[model samples]
Every structure is written in C-alpha cells, then in structure tokens.
Target: MVAGRLSRYFGRRFLGASLTVFVGVFGLVLLVDYIELMRRSAGEANASALLAAGISVTRVPQIMERIMPFAVLVGAMLCYLNLSRRLELVVARSAGMSAWQFVAPAVIAALLVGVIATAVYNPIAATLQEQSKRLEDRAFNNAAQSGLQATGTGFWVRQRSVDGQSIINAASSTDQGVRLGGVTVFMYDLAGRFVERIEAKAAVLEEGYWRLVEARRYPVDAPPEKLADHQLKTNLTLAQVRETFATPETVSFWDLPFFIEMADHAGLAAAGYRLQYQKLISRPALLAAMVLVAAAFSLRFFRFGGVQKMVLSGIVAGFLLYVLSKVTEDLSKAELMHPAAAAWLPVFIGVLTGLVPLLYLEDG
Candidate 1:
C-alpha cells in the first residue's frame, strides 16, 4: 500500500490538502484570537498590539496542533469528495478498486503528519507559549508582583511535618516558590488548633525554610509582634513549586518523561504530564482514525445533494471528539480515573468509532 505510482499520487494529494487546511485554519485562529486579545485589553495601559499579535501567533501552533485531527477529517473529506465529483473514484471503483485500497495513502499521510507534529512542532509551540505568558505578565501583571490577581484571592500551598500543618499563600509568585509577595502563613498544631498567623511583605525560599522579610507574627492568645526576619521549616523544594502551576502543554513530548520524574520526586502531581505523554504517543492512531471518519462521510457525490450534510456531520463529530478529550482530561487531573486510562480511552473510542463504520461500509 505504501509503494506504487497510484499510492504516491494519492499520498501527495492527501498531504497537500492537509497542509493547506492546516495553514488556513492556523491563520484563521491567529486572527480571531489576536482580535479577542486586543478587545480584552482595550482599556489597559501599555498593551502593545504587536506584542499581542505575536502572542496570538505563537499560540496558533498549539491550537492548530489540537485541531489537527479535524483538519485531517476535512482534508480527507475534501480530497475524496473532489475525486468523486471528478469521476476519479467512479473510474477506480469500476476498475475493481475498493475504498479501503485508495484510503490507505491518506491514512499513511496522516500518521506521518501526526508524528512530525508531536515530535517537532510541539516543542516550538511550548516555548512560544511560555514566552507569551511572560509577555502577559509584563503587560498586565506588573511582572507578576501582584498576588491573588483579579480574583481577589491568591494561590495556596501546604506543608505537613512534625511541627504541625501550615498553609501558605501569596498574591503572586515566581515559577519556583522561591520568591513571593504579599505573603501570609497560617500554622495549626497536631490537633488542628490555630497556633499563629504570620504576615510578610515578601518571602523567599531558602535552604530548609522560608525566609520572611518585614514580618509580623500574631500568636493565638497574644498581641502582634513585629519582626525584621523569620524562618519557617518546609519540605517543599523549588522544583515542586515550579511544577505546581505548570500545565501539561507547557512541557514538550521529549521532555515530559524527565518532567514527570522530577515532579513526582518533588511531591507534585504528575498525572497531567503522564496523560499528555500518553496522548502524544497516540497521535498517529488518532489521525488515522480521523481519516476513516472522513471516508465514512465522503464517498458520495455532491450531485446527490446530501454530501454537504454529511460533511457537516463529520466536522461536528470531530468537534465532539475534541470536547470529549478535554472532559476526560479534567477527570484524570482530578484523580477520578487513572491517567493512562483517561488519556488513551478517548483516543481509542474515537478511532474505533471511525474505523468500525469504515470497515462495515467498505467491505461488508
């Protein structure tokens, strides 16, 4: 199936169509997101349109990557529908060729495209996304010094040790919990009774403890005491803090293994990275599945008047698949299901849903 003049021709057609659709969709996404960003920042000071545009563009690759399966679906639909319209498929069918035979090239092409996207394009997207976040912090977050942000609350982290339990909060923090501003600490004894409240203008993560500056401590039964400096013991490390808010997409496929290991060692949740790793490895199969879905909707000619409806149905199905994946991811992140099961189950279901229909229609 991978070799022959006809196979080459079909492969070229499929690859060309998919690439064109990917480019077009990426551009459309960039324009829409850029405009949205600008609209949101309309009243904000120092919001550069060019910077916003650049951030939007950088985000396009990642968004495009997510929708690549949909592109494959549309591309295959377009390619096959055109062939049917031009009577190419009719000729092939008359020559004793079957749908499965011709669809092989497109399936192969989709597999290759998925592999390249996961391996190469993903890393670049992640880097640019990180850059976009930095730009956002500078533009609106005052370089991330403002803690708890617009929501009127801050992030919370916890520590439990022989000393008792403590909850930490900051208005904003660095990637690592190394530095924080507008910090507060609440400590409780082994029995969960309140022991003290500590407030600080700033906090820095030092070896074995947190170093607080401009600190005031209020004991449970005593008045507030001002202090120049204070130390609180901590088991959390810099890596754990850095990984806390790090979403799966920020880590590349190649780096995910190491990231997961480090995150687990640092006592951070590693399920997100594990789930992303599973998804990355399953991309090729998912794209091929999309090709099958396209074929299921594409074999009819436009002259029959129902082709448009089928195409719409196919596109809607692709969107549903994306939505399903997101839902499963949330469930996995919440620990309701095993990470491997959550990531792979959706892909498997999507592939089977497409493949089974193609098998019955093509050969049955």
Candidate 2:
C-alpha cells in the first residue's frame, strides 16, 4: 500500500512537471511561428493575402512535431532538474527511494509522450505538411504542373517516353512504378503524325523491355476494330517508372507496402521506403531511448552545481545523437548498412551512453 501511494504521488508530480514543460516549449514554438508569419506578411500587398499567410503559419506545429524527440529530452530534463532544485529528489532519497525509483515516473512519462507522438502527432503532421505544401505551391507556382493524385484504389502519373518528346498519360500505376494500370500511350511522330495508339490493362517494366498485359495495338492506317490483344515492348526501366512517381513521403505509412512491392516489380530500389518502414517499426524503442537519454542528462542535478554546463552538455549530446541517427539512416538507405543496424544502432548507443552518466552521478 505504501509503495502504491508513493508511486501515485511520484506520478502526479511528474505529470505536472511534464505538463509545465510542454506548455513552455509549445508557447516558444508559437511565438517563433507568429514572428515568421509577420515577417513574411510584411511584403504582402493585400490584407487577404496576409490573412491566408497567417492561417498557413499555424502549420508550424506540424514541422515542430518532427522534433518531438528533442522536446521530450528537454522537457524530461527540466522536470528532473526542477525536482532536484526544490530538494524533492533529496527528500525522496532520504525517504529510502533510490535514484532509479525517483526517475522511474519521469521515464514512463516520456515513453507515453513518445507513443502519443508516433500514433497521433505523426499523422497530423503529415496532413498539415501536405496542406502547407499545397498552399505554397498555389501561392508561388500558378503554372506548375501538379503531381499525380491518388485515390483509395490507384494513382495517376504523367511521364515522357525515352524519345523525350512524347508525353504518356498513365491513369494509374502499380508495382512500384513498374506496372501501369488503365494506361493509354499516345504515340506522335516528330511531325505530330497520328503514328499509332496503344491501350493496355497493365504495363510491366523490365530491363530494356515493357511487358504489356492484355494489350491492343493500333497502327495509323489500321481500323480501331482490327486491333488485337498483344504485348507491347518498350525501352523503359524500373528507375524511369519510380522517377515519375516522386518521393515516398507523399504516401502514408499504411500505403508504403503497396508502393514497395510496386518498386520491386519495376526492378527499382526501394531503399528509402524500406528505411522509413523500419523506422516506423522502431518507434517505441526510439521513444524509450529519448526518455533514457533525457534522464541521463537531467538526473544529475542533485549532485551537479553547474546548471548552465549541464544544459549545454545535454543539448550537445542530444544534437550529436540526432546527427548520428541521420548518418545511420543515410547509410542504411544507401544499402551500405543493415536495415536493423541502421534503425536501432543509434538507439542502443544512446541508451548505453545515457546510462553511463546516470550511473556515475546517481549510483557511484
């Protein structure tokens, strides 16, 4: 019963501390976002434009969501540091609580925050990012061609043939860019002659060859009824197919598998999508690591007198860890590093590195 009471008490305290930290951080983000919007609006010639810009500025939270790990680190560090500064940590230790016991609540809180970020914040961020991009494009590029649009069933794309003159309107694509669904390839000679027409249910990209599925070929002089089901060949490769689709970020996590398979069928590399997939799976571990790292940096306040030094050290350590993660991600994407290694190595190293400082200050 005593242990339960103590745990509840600690939980409440940690919760309050975390809430305080989040508010402070979120306020700072809002302030910066507002200031940026103001600066951008200064050059605008009209009130309506400024209003639209202001509305777009609210999307900063989505950008900031990407930095949630940093926020968790800073917030958890502040929570522990504040507790230590108020002598609450000392009192808890005097009451027979170990350093680990005092830290357990904050660690758990950070993990919870991480889970919320992954499941909730990420999708919201993705949506807001798309909105922001669309706003910017409409504002700046009135004549720019929009990318392919997707529905629940398929996506549309436009690509140029190898001759770099003919435009292909592929109504939908599959097999990672290798296969075209509901395809209509319009062939025009240099003189814009109605040379030929090809219709196919699917088009599969192979090395220097495209295998058309249930295809019908028509020559300029041939009647439409004379066309027969036949395979059409092309010089397009898997790389060309994916190039027409653009980045994987436009697709949501739920849609990655389908795209990955499409890429595989096209004989193109799906390394970027693969990395994102692995990273998504490692979300829980990454969040747990952030909490541990935060604990390691801030849990020393009881013994350390140099607040500025510790804060700077924590910031530097966090920055280095983030950089390391990016480098590992790049290497993994390049196929030079194992997917598992690229995804989890930084987390493992961060946890171990964090534990060393925590142990030295709290236990030793």
Candidate 3:
C-alpha cells in the first residue's frame, strides 16, 4: 500500500509538472509565431490578425509535438528536483524504495503522454496545418471564390530515362502518394529539347512504372494525341513517390496502415510511412526512457553542491540525443539503414543508458 501510494503521488506530481511545461512551451511558440506571421503580413492587404492567429495556432501544435520529449525530460527533472530539495527522495530511499521504484509513476505518465500525442494530437495538428494552408491561399489569391485548388500541394519530382528527363507535377495525392490526380509530365530529350508533354487525368504507380489514364501526348509542332491508356517507364518506386510529396509528419499514425496497403498494391516502397508508424508506436517507450534519464540526473542529494551542473549535463545529453536521432532519420531516409532499426535505436540506447546509471547509483 505504501509503495502504491508513493508511486501515485510521484505520478501526479510528474503529470502536473509536465502539463505546466507543455502549456508554457506552447504559449511561447504561439507568441513568437504569431508575431512573426503578423509582421510578414504587414504589406499584404488581405492579411489580418485573425488569420495570422489561426496560422500560429495550427503551426504551434506540430512544433510542440517536436518538443514533447524535451518537455518530459525537463518536467521529470523538475519533479525529482523539487522532491530532492524537500528530502522526499532521500526519505524514500531510506525507507527501502529505490530511485527506480519511485520513478515508476513518472515512467507511466510519460507513456500516457506518448500515446495521446500519437493518437489524438497528431491528427488535430495535421488538420489544422491543412486549414492554415487553405487560409493562406485564400488570403493571398482568389481561391475562396473558385474553391481552394491543389496545384502546389505536394513536392515536384524529376526523373531521367533514355527517352528524356521527365518533370512531374502532381496536384494532389493520397497519403500513400502513389495515386495522383491532375498530373502533368513534361518530357525532354537528352539535348534539352522538348520531346512531348503527357497530361494525365490520373496516375497510379505500378511496378517499375506509372500507369496513366486518359492521357494526352502533345508533341512539339504536332497535334496532341489522345490515348485511353499510357505507360511511363519509371525507375522510381512507390517509396520514392511517397517521399516526393507526403512527408512523414503530414501522415497520421492511424492512416499509416492504409497508406502502407496502398503502396503495397502499387508495388512501391512504403518505407517512410512504415518508419513513421514504428516511431509513433515506439514513442511511449522513448518518453519512459526520458524519465529515467531525468531521474538519473536529478535524484542526487540537494547538498551535493552541483545540482545546476547536473541539470546542465542533463540538458546536453538531451541535445545529443535529439541530434543523433535526426542523423539516424536521414540515414534511414537515404536507405543507409533499415527504417525500423533507425526509428527504434535511439530509444533503445536511451533506455539502456539511463537505466544502467540509475541502477548502479541505487544498488551499489
């Protein structure tokens, strides 16, 4: 009963501190982004305060999502620091509860945070970002009257074949990015001559190529040829197509499976979505590891005379973790490593590194 009570107490404290940090960080992001957006809109006649606020609100969530791990780290640190200052942790240790035992609640809290972030917060952020984009388009152009169009929605891609270099413009695409609409492909010859342009009503990625429907080929100095079906030879895979437009952040965890299925059907690579899904699933574990890391630094006695130093060290360690994570993600995207391994390695390293030191400190 005592153990359970202590765990609950610490968990509540950690959660409260985490919430405080969450609000503070988001509030700061909102203030900064709103001010910047408002300033940038100074010369635009249509830009208004409300629209700027909307963009800031939409953008802040995703920015907050990126900082969540750091929040957990700092929140847990604050929780432990406050307890240490009060000698609560010392008393708990004296009473036979190890640091790890007392930190269990914080671990659980971080796990819950991770779950909510993945399932609930992500979708909300994605929707808000899309709405923000639409608002920008309407404010700058006459899109509201004609309806918002998808002309510049996704990334543009270029591919080379013996036939020529092909520049692809897809007005819109599914999250899987294999199915495209309003696609225009401009083909050029090796000597930089215009060969022909193929405009397709829609395109579906097929194995090693693209299957275009309702395609029209417009040759230079010739009449356009209408074709019921067209095939464009592509060295690009489904995975490559997916990367060209749908960044991992834009796709939600719940929708990743659907995207995977679509890519699989198209015989394209779904590595990006697969990696993102794995990362989302691994988030709870990663946050739990963060708590352990924070605890390892903050559980020392208040009289140790280096509390600030310890805090600084913890901050540096967190920074290193973030930098290494970015490096690994780039490597995974470049196919230098398996996506699953890239996604989980940092979390694995964090847990082990944090746990080992704490275990030694407490048990030794």
Candidate 4:
C-alpha cells in the first residue's frame, strides 16, 4: 500500500512538472513566432493582425514538435530538483528506494508522451503544417509556390523541367524520388506556343533518364488525331525527382508506408521516407533514452552545488543529442549510414552515457 502511494505521488509530481514545462516553453515559442510574423508583415502596404494571429497559432504545432525534447529535459529536471530541494529523494533512498525507483515515474511519463506524440501530436502537426501552407498561399496569391502541404491523396510537387524552362506537375513520386505518377510534362517552344505534352501514368527515374509508362504523347504541330500513346525517354533521374518531393515531415508516421509505395510505383526515390519510417519505429527507445538522459543529470542533484547548474547542464546535453540526431538523419538520407543506425544511434549513445551516472548514484 505504501509503495502504491509512493508511485502515485511520484506520478503526480512528474505530471505537474511536465505540464508546467510545456506551458512555459509553448508561451516563449508563441512570442517568437508572433515577432517573426510581425517583422515579415512590416513595410507591406497593409497588414492583418487577425490573420497574423491565426497563422501564428497554426505555427504552434510545428514549433511544439521541435520543443518536445527540451520539454522532457526541463520537466525531468524540475521533478528531480523539487524532490531534492525537499529532501524527498533522501527520504526515499533511506526507505530502500534507489535512484532508479525514484526516476521510474518520470520515465513512464516520458514514454507516455512519446506514444502520444507519435499517435496524436504528429498528425495534428502535419495538419497544421498543411494549413500553414494554405495560409501562406492566401497571403501571397501564389498557390503554386506554397510549400509542403500534406494530403491523404499523396505528396504532390511542381517544378521546372530541365533545359532551363517548362513546368512539370507530378501528382506523386517514389524510389526516394526517382519516379513520378499522374505526370503531366509540359513544354513551350521559344515562340510561346505549347510545343509538347507528355502525360504518363507513371515515370521511372533511372540513372540518367526517365522512362514513362502508359504514356500519351502530344505534339503541337501534329493534328489532334495524330497524338498517340508512346513510351517516353527523358534525361531526369531518380535523384532529381526526389528533390521535388523532399519534405518528409509533412507526412505522418501512419501514412508513410502508403506514400512510400506510391513513390515506388511512380519510380521516385523513397529513401527519405524509408528513413523516416525506420525512425518512427524506434521512437519508444528514443523516449526512454530521453528519460535516462534526464535522470543522469538530475540524479546527482544532492551532490551538485546548485539546481541552476544542473538545469544548464541538462539543456546542453539535450542540445548535443539533438545535433547528433540531425547528423545521423542526414547521413541516413544520403544513404551513407544504415537507416536503423541513423535513427537509433543518438538514443543508444544517450542511454549508454546516462547509465554511468544512474548506476553510480542509484545502484552504487
């Protein structure tokens, strides 16, 4: 009964700390986003505060996505610091509880946050991101230039074709970005007349050429009746196709597989999507690692001189972990690293490094 009570107490403590951290961090993010929006609107003939506020609110989800790790760090720090300040940790230790036992609630909380983040927050963020793009289009009057809009219909991209001109509309892409689907390849000659149109059910981006499938070819000089289905040959490669469909963040974890398959069918490179897929599977471990990293810093609160120093150290550690994770992601996208390794390496390193302090403070 006493153990149950202790668990509940710790759980409540951790929950309160996490909530406080989230609110504080979110407020700061809102301020920064609002300021940036204001700066961008300056010197414009007219500005809409209401529009800016709505856009800023929409931007919150994206900012929150980036802020979650820091939130974990700060929240964990607060939980530990509070316990240490009240000597609750010492009392727990005296009662035969180890550092690990004291940290268990926080760790569980972090895991819950991770699950929620993957299943709920990420999808919401994806939606907000798409909305943000629409809002930007409304602001600029150029829907075509709007970037990274998420959709269940699959990823879409518009780009200029090679030879320095012409627009290509690709409804979907695959193979890390080497194939395209529902492709409409349009070209205009120097005379400003539509010179050619190539519509393909799919296009494969090979080494130096795009091989169109179920294609229809149209020549401006030819009679409409003369237009015929023909396999196409073009100089665009898989890499170039990938460049057009590059924002992997707009797709949710649950939707990545379908997107990847669509890309594969369209003959585009799916490497980035593939990497993101592997990363999502490893998220539980990553969450556990964040908890462990936090515990490592906070475990020494009794021995450390000041709570501020511990908090500072935790922030620095979190930043380094973030940087390492980004580097690994880049490596994975470039195909220079294994997808699993790139996704999990930071977590592995953080957990392993964190273990030393945990063991010393708790087990020893």
For candidate 4, give the lDDT of residue 317: 84
**Which candidate ranks first by TM-score, i.e. highest?**
1
Model 2 Cα RMSD, 1 decimal: 9.4
Candidate 1: tens digits of C-alpha lDDT, residues 33-117: 9998898678769678987887687667777778888888888888888888888777777767777777888988889988988
lDDT of each: 0.78, 0.63, 0.79, 0.69
Residues 244-268, candidate 2: write the lDDT tens digits. Answer: 5545554456656776787777677
lDDT (10s digit) by residue, model 4, range 25-118: 8888888887887787665444466666677787788778767777777787778778887888777767777777777877787778788888
The TM-score between candidate 2 and the true structure equals: 0.67
Tell me the TM-score of each prediction against the true structure.
0.78, 0.67, 0.77, 0.74
Distance from true location, Cα of 214 in model 2, Å: 34
User: After superposing candidate 3, which stretches have Cα over 4 Å from the reference?
Assistant: 142-154, 157-244
List residue ranges in candidate 2 displaced over 4 A.
12-58, 141-246, 301-304
Report backbone clashes per prediction.
3, 3, 2, 18
CA lDDT, candidate 3, residue 312: 89
For candidate 3, report its TM-score.
0.77
For candidate 1, the clash count comes to 3
Every model: Cα RMSD to truth = 4.5, 9.4, 6.9, 8.7
